[model samples]
Target: MSRWSGMPRTTRWVVRVIRPFLQVFTRRDWSGADRLPTGGYVLAPNHLSHLDPFLISHFMVDHGIAPRFLAKDTLMTLPVGGRLLRGTEQIPVYRNTEGAAESLQAAVRAVEAGQVVTIYPEGTLTRDPDAWPMSGRTGAVRVALATGRPLVPMAQWGAQEILWPYSRRLRLLPRKTVRIRIGDPVDLSDLEGRPLTEDLLHEATDRLMDTLTTMLAEVRGELPTRPRLDVRTLEPPRTTYKRLEP
Candidate 1:
């Protein structure tokens, strides 16, 4: 059984308690939820805020799937936060460190065990000043390809409006509406059995990004004049332990 199978029922109940409050602050409307597989799969969503995981996972809760996320390893050192993450089966990625492979292996095992893994392919929350999705990395692509699982491309908006990235403060003024749209499963069947190459990886990554861009555009009610391809190379900062101390 997955280690997280033991997650206290109260944890989900607690989330439910806060759900209405979140909705009041940022009304949520999710589409294409049917596309999410109840069994093993990967959820690759555009990262915009720290709330992305909780927001997406909330929509996914009723589907008999609990999201196991790829978080920065330093989060594991936090007093209670680390225990909570482990209890929820979140995989920790040690950025720019040797232990990253181990984290990847843990994610693979989770998928193999029929759990959904949600990843922010951009690695960090969007740095797009405007809150657009940053350039994605190949971690999600590699995981999906290696596991042969469907990649559900999720597009989320308004999260940044709720909790601005890299800010010490939250925005309670705007009271924006958060919308999450899940696109159809990205078919990677074409790459199956083919040798994994740089071209293949890039193509797959681009396809995922394209899907996300299209979805986000729909939510924002705007279209891109030109294809923006600036990939952000900055890594996510280590999750600080001090913040978790009581």
Candidate 2:
């Protein structure tokens, strides 16, 4: 039997406690919820705002799946925040540290045991001027490959409207629709069994990002006129730890 079976009680409780408060912040127009399998799937979605986590976690909780994530090491160290993360069984990505491998391994186990691993592949919020999905890292792909889990691609809109990332502004008035739609499992069958080489992983990552970008296009009703911004090309300090390479 899978160890991660069943919805996480902590998630359900958090969502229940926060749902009413969340409604006070933004409205929701969620779709493709039926697309959410009971478990053992990689939840890949575009990162727009810090609010994405709460919104996505709320989505999972409402739908009966325990919302889990690979959080940053710093978050896992905060007094209260770390306690909650650990209490809920969230994995930690020891970013920029050697421990990053441990986080990837944990994600694989979570998926194999039928748990939801929500990952923001853009790593952080989109530095994309247009907020199109940035070039993705291979961390999510590696976990999928290792555990043979389906990487379910999805796109979200309106969370940024409520609170843009890195901006202290909050425009919570006039409830906004946190539109989210879950798409089909990305087809990585061709690359699954091959040796997990750097080039191969990059190619797989491209396909995964492409699928997510297309979904974002559908959500926005407009395709990005410019190419995706590579966070790696940015300032060295910002590059930090992106994907967990093979």
- Choose the strongest candidate by TM-score: 2
Residue 128 error for model 2, in Å?
1.4
| Residue-wise C-alpha lDDT for candidate 1, range 108-173, written one tens digit per residue | 888878878887877876655466676677778888888998888999887777676665456766
Q: After superposition, how far is residue 94 of candidate 1 from its true place, in Å?
A: 1.7
In angstroms, give how far residue 74 of model 1 lies from its true place. 0.3
Give model 2's TM-score versus the native structure: 0.90
RMSD of each: 5.3, 5.3
lDDT of 2 by residue, 199-225 (tens): 988888899899888888888999899
* lDDT against the true structure, each candidate: 0.75, 0.80
> How high is the lDDT of residue 83 in model 2?
82
Q: Candidate 1: misplaced stretches above 4 Å? A: 1-10, 13-17, 225-229, 232-246
